[model samples]
Target chain A: MRASIVQTSVAVVATLLLFYPVLQIVLLSLNKLPYFRLGGEFIPTLESFQWVLQQPEFWRGLLNSLVVSLTTVGILLALSLPGAYAFSRYKFKGKDALLSFYVVFTQVSGGLGIAGLIALFAIVSALGLRNNLFALALIYAAGAIPYHTWLLKTYIDTIPKSAEEAALIDGAGVNTLMLRVVLPLMAPALAVSSILSFIGAWGELILANLFLSGENRTLILWIYSLMSNVYSVQWNRFAAAALLYSIPPVVLYVVLQRFLKRGLAFVY
Target chain B: MRPQWLILPGLLLFLFFNIWPIIYSIYISFTNANIKNFPPPPPWAPEELKQARPPPDFVGFANYASILTGPASSGFLGAVFWTLIFVALSVPAKVALGTFVGLLMSSDRVVGKPIMRALLIVPWALPLIISVVAWRYVFDPTYGVVNQLLYAVGISKPPDWFVNKDYAYAAMVVIEAWLAYPFIMTVVMGALANVPRAAYEAAYIDGAGRWAVFTRITLPLIKRPLIYASVMTAAASLQFFLVAFLWNFIQLYDRFMLAYGYYWAFGSPFREYGLAAAVLTMSALLISVFMILAIRLAGLMRGMYES
Candidate 1:
């Protein structure tokens, strides 16, 4: 089929519109000034990057973000993997009911709103878990359970049960079966799930801002604080930090792109 | 060895982290819990620190009453009104634009389909905070690309987005659509691929026009996925917070349901925890009601489990 001029033009324009904000950020990160102006002078330099790199908070925030995200992924997989395996293999009473519950729970999980936050704050404070990065990661992982379990359950359903049966017949223990047999085969799904959870924990702001403080702030939180500063914001440094912060998630999403369709299938 | 035992650990974690807060929130909403009264030091702390604060008093639905019919009602109602409007407008915009782009790019006729798709995916791929901040920049009154483009096109004095309520809301809807459309597009692209080419061929061979083919064949085929996407996006829009919160946190804090609760709980000087809990509980109830209904309407759980 011949490409229509109208369709091509519309698509091109839409692409440009979508890409402009990111392009603007890229430009702002490179621009010499701390702020942007329309038709601004275009002297580009690495000063903003240098400034961001020089800040001790930058390294701390990045490390905190990494710790939180990786721990979240670890906890998420440990919980969701076994849960998904059971859901896929077992026929328990209330199975459908529980699955339906998960469907609803995952859908409105974010709707917990301030009520969840306030109650969580109270709990975290009471337990003295405030500013604790691992506890924060646990919270992140817990929030992800229903959806990731369902997601991995769906993926597991596709894998033949014959292998597990064969392993059982060979006197393989359940632990060995899971650790050696299931885990390796489920790598792709595990990768998708972990990467998703990692990105989620990495980019999360509200909970991180509420639960963490001072030196414990995540990279996204640090960048947000810079922007939220009322009196003056160094926009160039903010843009540079934001772009740097965005790299991991963007790269992960692109990697996950191949599996996105299948993932959405499980989600809906 | 019961397979069910495997689910226990995750279930306990979910109960602790997800379910417990909600239950606690409901319990707290009925009490006059504020920053001072609640959040007493851990029981493990010394007796003096534990004795430093008294327990919260039970208010017995007073918070709900105040939010329902008292002075705080206006903010709550206004948030409800605008949240509904935002969801109503933005969900369709996102879905439609996504469908349009998905259809255009999925077609064999589109040039550089790979590049176009990659460019489109940027918004969805980038961290959401970054995207929102970049969009906040793009809508900046003085130096924003939106205004710059408006000026270049001979429309001077484009309304300052963050300064005006309507413009800010409009910018939010635009940003929401931009952030979300890629997912819808991906879903549509996936659904479209499932559509049998023979069906389209059969329609064309019968002399059906493009519009007829689309409305009759294409739409019906992708209807379920589209409905699913709409329901999910609508839920997301209903819970909309961060973009608006980031755009102009203080001014717009009371304009969305979650943000309103946020204002009461944290942003406001009073820090009315009970009242904020009441507001958020109502919001959560509304969202669950909408989601359950939509899910039921779409029969989304029909094949979710086998046994």
Candidate 2:
């Protein structure tokens, strides 16, 4: 009984510590005080949200984030579906090697290696593609491909080949079989990949910073700029922006929580 | 075989965007390429221009030599040393805390497991940059929550977290640990669920205490996931850009001409691409070595794959 009480207390404390910062941010966003104090006594107000909404950059950044995220998910699906199918079905020479390579490469750091990426971008730009949203999307998609492919490949392998063999016997072409037969069965995996890709593109800062400069900053960059605009930290505005920034991901988690958990169980 | 062709576009894209750039950057590191030498000097330039130029010359080992012996050499070594310090301090704390919390949550006796798990995921699920920014605010010296709390508790003088080099790295480590533990916790909770209950029961029957059962059964069983988590954490730490960048912005404010330039000069900025590459390559090499060692040590990789 004593041990149980201690365990319960520890769990409660851990939970409180975990939620404290988030609660602080929410409170700070609502507080009307110019400065945020640890235990500030102030009536809540909507001014922070008002200020965040009034910013033209906020709306534009949000729009850009949505576009980039959607594009990235689309490209990821397009590339990974076929690629994953090939890996799952085919027994080509060097198949295991290729799969292992992607698995290892998936562990590479994303944004920390920006210098190399920038050098590559410089080369790509010289080839006539200027730095823009599309280029950024392509880079994001490429970054996600190896991981998504590995993920989808594992999920797709769980799907039996008998289904595809049956579809082929019905005079279905390979593409049609993939589209009509395999895709529907892989819906849960697809949903998981889509959400993962969206969240990745949504919150990605480093690549967005390096690649999307000058009139193409993503939403996170815009929020970062807002935070560091001047000497005085705009606590209210930053909180409002954070709350708004968190909405899409929060909604994503809530809506797909079940499927996402199931998919993660498969991967991890 | 035709289906294999589907991988062509992805393979080519990976080669171009991922593999090719990595190789090219490795090559560029050996040369004296900087921002100015980017376009490469005009085909024909004056002798003085040539003399004054810090061209992309094949001065083999010069850049590495400069990093080792330059005036900024200490800072470079310090950054690497600090990175290791941060990783050493943060990773184990994260793993231990995560494992403990995960075990608590995974246990059937724990109350509010769902809520605890959700709360744990919050830190990890938040956009890392946003969370770092939030943490920066929390650690703000004046009027910030952390300092305010500390001052209230009678510790009147709170250290300047971001400015004081002595504490800055420590602060960074704490925040990094905070951001990272949830991830480790979630993965660990999953791994712990797979821990065979029978083994623990057998340990108990053999008069093993909780510690012995954990050490003999749980720890050994979860070793592979633990190794994977540690390697991933180490790799992620090697790319510690955002904390340094954001800390510079928040702490330094408008004092510096270039927030990024300072990072390049001292932190892992683009100008020192070679050094950064070397650092990253070394990190990757170390991670690979650890991974192989982990496989050998655990003796489970073959079993896991073969099964």
What lDDT would candidate 2 get against the real structure?
Answer: 0.70
Model 1's CAPRI class? medium
**Best TM-score goes to which candidate?**
1
User: For candidate 2, what's the RMSD?
Assistant: 4.5
Report clash pairs, candidate 1.
none
DockQ, cand. 2: 0.47
lDDT of 2 at A122: 51
Worst 10 residues of 2 chain B by lDDT: B252-261
lDDT of 2 by residue, B104-175 (tens): 887655677787788877886677766876776778887677788788799978888878765666677777
Q: A74-168 in candidate 2: lDDT tens per residue?
A: 98789988899899888787888887778756655353245355456456655544547777777778877888888898888788889889989
